[model samples]
Target: MSAFSLSQALAWIKAAAQSIDANAAHLSELDAAIGDGDHGANMARGMAAVTKKIDSAPPADLAALFKSVGMTLLSSVGGASGPLYGGFFLELGKQSAGKTELDAAGLAAVLGAGLGDIRRRGKAEPGDKTMVDALIPAIDALAAASDLAQGTAKAAETARAAATATAPMLARKGRASYLGERSIGHQDPGANSVALLFAALAQACA
Candidate 1:
């Protein structure tokens, strides 16, 4: 019964924004090895905007809250991540419509839907060494958990591990894909951000 509420989601997003902000430099460094070097800055800006809006007046419903974050990120963040990540949240909102709290199964269903949308929009998959690699496992872990808290924590851990796991994977999507085997040893920026999202949600659930 410890399902995450809109307020909790909002709080988690804000905390995630700050965490992203703190890690912006490191993220940028990571991206510099395989990306445009702006992933960190772009995500930081988008999350900061999301945090500001939520701080002003958080949404009460899941749809409204995620819509707000998605719209804000779409408007603020630049590059491929803006629309991709923003759309991910928007899709999750659509899946969670009318629900204030989601049990493990409910959370899993919504997350699966969200990942499907992201894959459709980004044209990536698990072995692509993109965020999907981390997100897919995290969602699976959440789905297998018995409760929201355990699910969130499992997702967070899975995301973190998957992000690190991506370092050895061959790139199959995004700009990194262009590097082929050369992309090895560098973590995908999107996976790192997804990890942050899961970590934030886990903290909020706590």
Candidate 2:
């Protein structure tokens, strides 16, 4: 558990798929309040693709495996979430190149890179009601945690907290922003998904 492996990463993807599937209706409900009403379905389809790819032929290393997931999700899923989350995982694969197991510092760096990719791709800043708010704080918490398990749990908690905090904030990015002030009082779909991502990681790592 000190370092993540391809199998472990695949396990995370599977867990994330299950989480997304389980929450699909809720995610759709949340998106209907602010978006096109496809966040849940899109994420579920994307993760299902990733799980299928891994089941067919698991990659040899972490980088290849995660990259495969990224590409699969990007192709199989549509909407803003596909490219944003796809880029996040692609950046993670790049950051984790040549490593099977990552230490605490390595985890921080990979998550940082992933967050940067999300920000750049989405052109989002904190408080924009985008995934960046959750991802950035989750990474910060993971960086500060003492161990991998603790770090992942902290990351999940941070994501959940950030998503909740978004309820009162006006959306400034993505489809949610089109709602103007009406966006307030709704949890961002992306932020909720970010929470699911970290929670899946925690489950896999545990």
Candidate 3:
């Protein structure tokens, strides 16, 4: 088995932060159409804080690493994203307890755990115009892949497509839901961010 190293995992984290930073404006622009117009900024700030936390504390294992990211986002990010995204990572920490590296199956478990918590906390399902839209499909793709190489790449692709697909979906959760029919044409910023992070994961592993 080709084990996914701790270094690769850390690289994924850093890359995710960088990706979010780069796409902050675009994310916020997407949010402006259907949300409070601050998702990009909020996520950028939260990811930055998570980076600092990682740099300063440098967690010892997968569990601690994910925990630091989750807690940092919870404390630093504003709005509903703080809890939803933070809870996702926290669940990752819980599932990853006592480990450093992951095989294909282990990676799937971690991702599934994260998605499970997001669904639980956000009360969102697929096509909800939320991150759940992208995450659910991505995790499913990852779980079905033959290995990490194929899995991460396929997950990223699936998430990207799912995010794009959200544009036509009616909002059923979160602030976007408040808009009802008006939310139908706009893409979900949260789903885009989920897509970006998944792309970062694929890149880091490649």
Candidate 4:
């Protein structure tokens, strides 16, 4: 796809919800190793709320859609994931305001804005073993792509790899930081969820 529309955005949200639901248990298990074990359930609940919001009162525009998703996640999810993920989507909405469709450059701007928001909100760096590790690489990959589909696909792949690479890193932020050296061998739950988000975006663009 050359451009991303409202329908495609909705599809991406739906796909994210489904992917979260399917991996909820695994996510929780991953979190149990280093952080709170509620990441999966919290994310699943938030995505369900987003789905309900979409089904009950469909957004009239891309901005509305992203805002609705962001707000719903903010209110429904638990733990730090609620605020961090919620802020990401809210910033995406803000960057995409007044736009009906996004081309490659527009999508890159939206993702970059979201990543910046996450960085500001969380104050975490790439090697902090947080979601930033996945998201930053994904943003870089998306920015380098030539088209929407290719960009999203590359982003998803890069995000997944980045998330996986976080396994050996020590946590410097969030609940995992409490573990210090103990957090080194475990994968970061937040990074996993970030990877899932990009994976869903890739599928939607495909």
TM-score to native of every candidate shown: 0.95, 0.97, 0.97, 0.98
Per-residue C-alpha lDDT of model 2 across residues 56-175, encoded as one tens digit per residue: 987888898879988998998888898988988898889889988886668888889988888888899889988888888888998997688888888888889998888888999988
Q: Which of the numbered candidates is closest to the native, going by highest TM-score? A: 4
- Number of the top lDDT candidate: 4
Give the higher-lDDT candidate: 1 or 4: 4
lDDT of 4: 0.93
lDDT of 4 by residue, 88-139 (tens): 8999899889999998778988989998998999999879999999988898
Name the runs in model 2 displaced over 4 angstroms.
none
Model 3 residue 65 CA deviation in Å:
0.4
Name model 1 segments beyond 4 Å from true: none
lDDT of 1 at 198: 90
Candidate with better lDDT, 2 vs 4: 4
Per-candidate Cα RMSD to the true structure, in Å, reads 1.2, 1.0, 1.1, 0.7
- Cα displacement (angstroms), candidate 2, residue 20, comes to 0.6
lDDT of 1 at 45: 88
Q: What is the lDDT of residue 154 in candidate 2?
A: 80
Give a tens-digit lDDT track for model 3, residues 1-206: 36677788798899999999999999999999998999999999999999999999998888888999999999999699999889989998998898878877789889898988888888887778899889988988988887887889999999999999999999998888999999998999999999999999998878
Deviation from native of the Cα of residue 177 in model 3, angstroms: 1.0
Q: Candidate 1 on 126-154: residue-level lDDT in tens?
A: 78888899999999999899888888898
Candidate 4 clashes between residue pairs 3 or more apart in a chain or in different chains: none
Off by over 4 Å in 4: none
